[model samples]
Target: MKKLIVICLFLAGWHSLLAGSPRNIMLILGSADPAVLQDRMDVALRLYTKQHFDKIIVSGGCAAHGSSICEASFMKEVLLKSGVSSSMIYKEENSKTTVQNYVFSRRLKEADGTLVMKPGDTVYVVSNHWHAISVAARLRKYDNLEAKFYIEGSIDPKPTDKLDYVSIFNGEPDNDKFVLKGTWLTPQAAWQEGDSTHYLTGSLVYVTDPQNMRFSVYERRKVFSGLEPYAAGRDLRFIDAGSSWYVWNGEKLLHVEKQERKVRSILSLTDLIPGLSPAWKYSLKAGAIYGDRLLLFSDSTLLVGKRKGKIFEIEQETAASAYFRNWPYSWGRGNVSAARIDPQTRKLYLYRNQECLELNAGLKSVQAPQSLRLKWIDKSK
Candidate 1:
């Protein structure tokens, strides 16, 4: 009887340990206005009273006004005032945007190299109601995160920012109503979603049939194809159910999705990087969504976004840095601007100027780049 009782107790203890193993509470920063800051803190204190998490992760860089103060630091003051134990709070002090909040905080890990918030850990995101929508959208992109989100209202509400976010959810980039336009080929972004090929040509977004290159429908304002750079599977667990695509139309940032078809892997670069400029004014220097990661190439730095709650970065001397060396004014067109994965899963292809280079799957090395053969592209047009 004693042996049997001991076994039962052991099982109970193991289950308890599993339940409390990864405790993470993340707070998204708000305006530095004292009243707004206090409101955010009040919401956090309320949640803490119910269940004090192992770590309270506060993220945000500045409190606006170009002051030396950061949002995370401002929030820390509120936490201390609210009586949250200093030991239990972890401040992510360098993030200025929502994406930075998620990326920088997730990089924090324990001494043994384990992530502070593991796959099964619960995450609580506290933000203003409007900001919380974008917050939830960005957070839910992580397939492994088990997050519980909460939003608070500002004491003096600002409708402009709030309405802008609403426009994004509605699939309109730049917070403007979708406009119609003519057929053109100077595309802002081009992607093959599922079997259908989509191109945001000029001011319009277009979708083509897989079997026969025929018009299916006009996906207006959906041309910011840079958003979901990686769609490899038939995954459908986005925070917003109606989202069929995510695109960035110029200054208008749409956290929208285009569910025109299904696939095995999907990757998005938006809200994944610490500091990213998805605006059309400053397009990504080079980016690709291959497999579960969105590969971004800026200068020599490469950022890999992992869907399983972690980001792994790879830095290497790019092969294209030497490409087109023989050509005059190579600096204008020689740099690699994009990458694509071969369906066979054996190699990756990178585009630079007029050449296409093939690399091993791991992207550690590459073959000599060859001039692209555009057999189908009508140069006459």
Candidate 2:
């Protein structure tokens, strides 16, 4: 009987040890309100103290006045005051955006070796209640780490405002209708919907292939009310009204248009990159420039020409290959831009005005080039 009782006690102790092991906690701080942010931090610190996480990484960057201090610094200060040792708290202060917070925090591991954890190592990520989903999705991209999230309660005790609730539910903030920043490639003609005559604040409309709707309209002004339609059998052109026209191919800024559009002087890859030359010009059936290659789809064949000294020369060696004969799987009516290649994933990402799409190799896939491998390393010290 004495031996059996000892065995039962040992099992119970082992279970407790397994349950109580510390997890690596990453806390994301949002907003610039000092009082509210501090309240959230206080809640996190208390939770950390109770659960006893192995280490804490605080994330945030510069904000408005009175809230200008980097969030990580403020968090580190609070943790130190709350009795968490300096050695156990890590600060990631350079991240001005939420995604950057995760990227920079991973970078912190280099300075503090303790931040490195192997596979199966549990991690706890804390962020505002509404932003939990996006943060989780981003973290899920990393196959090596497993993470759970906690949301700090809002400082305001009142019921969440209707707009605020909607924003949180939609995975963004409630302050703006739809924030439109950065240049966009839109069709010259678009169908306008709704009775407003002017574009509604958050009106949704299809740009091209009226049958197969594309991007939605976010913002519209009196001068730019209607949607740009898809002109078939006609050349599609864009005339920049601004003093300096910046031509963006939906990914990177390609070149600046200085003169008006005319047959003699047309926008070419040579104008964007200083030393490239234009080998030939077609009547604009399907033409686009990505990196150093000028791709044109015409006469049931795809032509890829190389740029050399302000001149483009067609590559005759592989000209017979039909790689891009049926290229551009889909082009959004709102923006006809090329996808931006992610160095980490080597996959092209397309941003159609408001929406985003990931370009894959497709049904019959081909191996990716060696250059696009994941280069992330454990920087934890």
Candidate 3:
């Protein structure tokens, strides 16, 4: 009887793991020539008609030919024309790159955004066969053992097929274990401020204890005994490209803003951009805050804008394409992994694992690249 009870308990736990469909499933659109847009749209339309999901987020930027109609807007139109309600479709028109599409789509939000994905949320990424591997890999900072992924097309994938992206998406095995490489391999997703830097690796939080200058890694313990948690990525201010301090509530990402001795939840963009018009909602192509002004990259120009009253307004200053064009080369061939800035030194630090670099505030390399010994951590949590 004792052996039978133990066997029954094991079976119950195993069954729980296999049950329940993911809370969110997204159909990530692939960008190709205008001629192929309809072909890709057809597959997604079929999927929409077949399966039931919480939300449908379409991600894409400008359709080639430098048109104002982005890919997400185009897909939204297609879905609406096919009898799908406009209310059911969400548009993510900010992504100019593939990595942006995946990362931006998974982000959690409060209002007027695509979708807000909390920490515990399980996202099932759906993409085409050719693009699935890269999309799945860049979705998170860790090994992503907790998430499940699927490739969508007319036909299902076969195990024996020899496809580069497919094999990569399926995960590579070394001897008996799978080898997964990503942002966690390098110190990419982080923020730094003053004497201490705070980093979020996997679900573990690490920061300088301050009382003792050495770093302390929080392992499921309450990092802040009683302080309220702040949003990790949303209410973030970059001290450099890679590291900064954040408020933690011990569970999910928190959203809070700090000024002088007071901190508050970010109620609206007006709090930061005082002069921003209430009716105007701009698609942020690329931007950074400098002094009282904000540098916005859009339409090939860097526009300098400042807070005035109800809304923040911007005007064209100079050509802005240089920064966007050089992004891939300066960072690496892949996603912009980890970057940080030293407030006191006024220099930017870009972590590349191979050879890290320190750049000036103008985004120019200040010195030759230097190598640093990097350490890899376990991702089971």
Candidate 4:
């Protein structure tokens, strides 16, 4: 009789532990299209109502060519309209890819540094049927919780849907919007030092010193006080996106090098660096000029044009290819809004929204990104 009583007590304790309250979380991956996003919301809403999910996590950032607002913001808006309480919804607004969705969502923390989704919690991922497999795979890799998938069967994935490799910048869809809103101090300061009015052409600061019969090139607005000797009839125009200075005149492009105090003309941009497509000019997002190479960043590509003594060559890689795979969550969407290389230190600085990331000379991340705010002088005040 005593043995039977002990067995009953042990079974009761096991039942209590198994029935502990584990939060049910509904994670909705985002889409760029409003119609598609609404479809996803419908699925999430149905699951939430039926299963009584404790929370919903909306994940995605502003797409490279999508609408102005981020995907998470749009999803949250739809969820609110459907009468889901704001307190039950959490937004993961920094993710732009499927891999990032799982990575960022799992790392979200509460006010007291506790994980938003604890170990025993259950996660239900709601996405299109085509995307469900990848979502499930990521959930298995990133989270140890019990996960269920709710896929909307109506929407089908297309071959043309290359969103997996899409690169995005923070803020508005238009790339030029960030520069247009502010009076940049770099170009203005470069012009002041050049003693001539200048304007930005492509990424180079073009300062025309007509009085001295020469043109000056400031690598992305790093100011040089003096001017170089000009070839009188040939008007030196914008420099190519390479370490070796290649100037474009009306007739031809010429690569020029400096020996001590004298500048020597060498070759043209096309002559040295082969396979440079004409489309590169239109796709240019940002660039930073260094002593040994020039780093050019486009929406989907990074071009490293290296120069050694007199030889020049170009190497290309997709922005989302390698570096991004290693640090998916921290790098945001694999492309930057703006880039600059410090002349003295050779450190690379990438700007995205209100954050700045510093990379060492070997192109390795130095530390966590720092908060960056562009402060303009309030002349009106």
Candidate 5:
């Protein structure tokens, strides 16, 4: 009798496991290119026809083309046209780069505030063949060994894959056509200020190369000069704080007016954080601005602080030896100048000397670092 009872219990446990199947989630990566976007949609459509998922997440951000139309939004419009129901599709518009595509998409939530992605769920990453390895690596690192991942590669667009931009924007204003105005350049430091995204780029033989550095302002698809040849020294770095701008002037942090280019000293960072002084030892660099707090990255540490009245208070400190280990050239050697945050997403971006890293709101986990670029589209074409 005891042996029979054990067998029955084992069978019941197996039945429970089989009944609780993992949810299927298809993550369609975003692209600004009409051809690429069409291909991704095509792949998603095919996958949906074969195996319908609980949710289809389209991921991309406006930083891709620098216009109001984000990659996810554009992809969503086409997906709807392609017969994918609005109920099944979710747009993730906070991702500006490939790393962001995975990071932001996973955090997507349902109407009930429950997480769309959960442990034991199966996530299908739909992207081009080129992103297969990179996507797999990110999935392993970010998924925290909870979920299973599959990559559906759309190597190239089919001959029949045609996108109708006219139909997509039919009901909209004729002047609101999206078009690229100029060449897209990789920036040393990038940040979002108000309605515009700013890039600090130039010759970077030093941390803040004042001799050749200039600020390019991207709004929509139009690129223009935000600051034309602003004068400063080698020890200067620009930080953006939503509505205003601040600068680390080698010795003290200062608030600067964009239009007038006037500066007021805030406080000496070295005095407040002694570990960051003596440039040779620490190679201190301002990383990004989060709310009222300022984030600074050194050779081996990530120091976060907030200004309280007349003094600056240290908030948190974490060992960032691993971050610098991957970036060997150090701070001053590369273009470690411009750092910014996306106003809509609240994700902090650290434009280092080598690559760009996307940090979550809490500054805890970081998306795999990659080159940072901004998209500018002339919507008023």
Candidate 6:
């Protein structure tokens, strides 16, 4: 009787896992190319028609050609033309990136224009094959949403595939459309006057680096107070890129200081935590902060430590695989500079170049699932 009871319990758990999987799916369109959007929408409509999902959300914003038409608007037209009921379609027209598409669209207003799903909603995400991994990671960051992704097609293009498919319906031809140029912005600095009584009478400094591409510091004081020289402090120090020496005063330029110390590469510098100098003994390639412990990755090893303390090495062999597996796909080709730790699931998320994959703790494996193949329906008259 004891053995039978255990078997029954095991079966129930397995069933629950399958049942809990997400059914509400979201399809993300990368480009405003009309043909591409139509093709993608056709697949999504067919998938929704067959599945038990309650709704479909299309997300995209502002074309690169400077026109007002958005990706979501294009998709809505195609979906409506395909016979899908207008009531079931949702549009998120403000998102300009893949991550924004999933994040903004998932919280779309209902038919009555009220927000749906409080939090902790399971959602499936769809996009092009190359974009599936990264989209999933960005979607996962939202604590309220659980994301699964599916890819559209293979990277290798087929002869039947349309060359101008993605740009067909746009106002301008594909050749005339403006392509989004890749660029990075520098961080700005600001400061405020400090209270004299608090022993910080000089000035309170604040640094803002939204893109994490550059760093800067600013000083501010009362109109009556004189400008004081910014001294070398543990919190802020400029490292000279040409030499290994430190700059006592902040440099006018916002370039990474060249270090004489033999380091692996620029990729190794990204792991430098805020308030922690780049000259630490163990260089961090990618890392994230969790409470008092700092999770660091370098080469193929994982290290955890506190600020200004020794690093305790964790598993080394699987660190590289685990890191690459969790990286986002939008970062492009080179190395990953971003990572995040999910407090709820205790899962580590990494974004390397343009690929994003997840590392499961139990299996210790990485899996990238492509978009589901839609039953192609011939809509030709």
lDDT by residue (1-381, candidate 2, tens digit) is 999999999999999987555456555554456666686686686677567577777766544233555566677787788888887776654444454454445534423223343345556667555454445444444525576667767534346544223332244232121121111221222222332211111222223232332333332222222222212222332222122222322222223332331122335544544442232222122334444565543212345567686555766322212342222222201122222333344443333222334444331113311111111211211
Candidate 1 per-residue lDDT, tens place, 1-381, comes to 999999999999999998667656665555546666667777777777887577787765543434445567678888888887888776665443454455556655543334566776668878655555655554444426677677766445565556335432344232212211101222334455677654443334556665444554353323333333432221111111122333322233234444443332334544444344333123233555555655554322344444444443333223233332332222222223445554555465555433456667665345455544222221111
Higher-ranked by lDDT: 1 or 5: 5
Q: How far is candidate 4 from the true structure (C-alpha RMSD, Å)?
A: 21.1
Q: Give candidate 1 regions above 4 Å deviation.
A: 1-24, 62-65, 154-381
Q: What is the lDDT of residue 354 in candidate 3?
A: 34
- Over the stretch 1-381, how does candidate 3's per-residue lDDT look in tens digits? 999999999999888865433445555554644534566677677766776655566766553234435577677788779987766666665454454455446542334332344444455455555565555554443334234456555645478665545344345343112221322233423445456655544345556544534656664224322222343333222212112122322222223232221233334444444554432223222333444445543222355566455344665355433442343232322222244546567665555433456667666766655544334444322
Cα-based TM-score, every candidate: 0.39, 0.35, 0.42, 0.40, 0.37, 0.35
Q: Residue by residue across 223-242, what tens digits does model 5's lDDT show?
A: 22223223243345556666
| Candidate 3 root-mean-square deviation in Å | 13.0
Looking at candidate 1, the ten consecutive residues that score lowest on lDDT are 232-241
Candidate number achieving the greatest lDDT relative to the actual structure: 4
Q: Which scores greater on TM-score, model 2 or model 3?
A: 3
lDDT of each: 0.49, 0.42, 0.46, 0.56, 0.54, 0.42
lDDT of model 6 at position 41: 68
Cα deviation of 154 in candidate 2 (Å)? 4.0
TM-score for predicted model 6 compared with the true structure: 0.35
Whole-model lDDT, candidate 1? 0.49
- The list of candidate 6 runs beyond 4 A from truth reads 1-23, 65-68, 111-114, 157-381
**lDDT by residue (tens digit), candidate 6, 236-283:** 222222222121222221222222223222322323333333333232
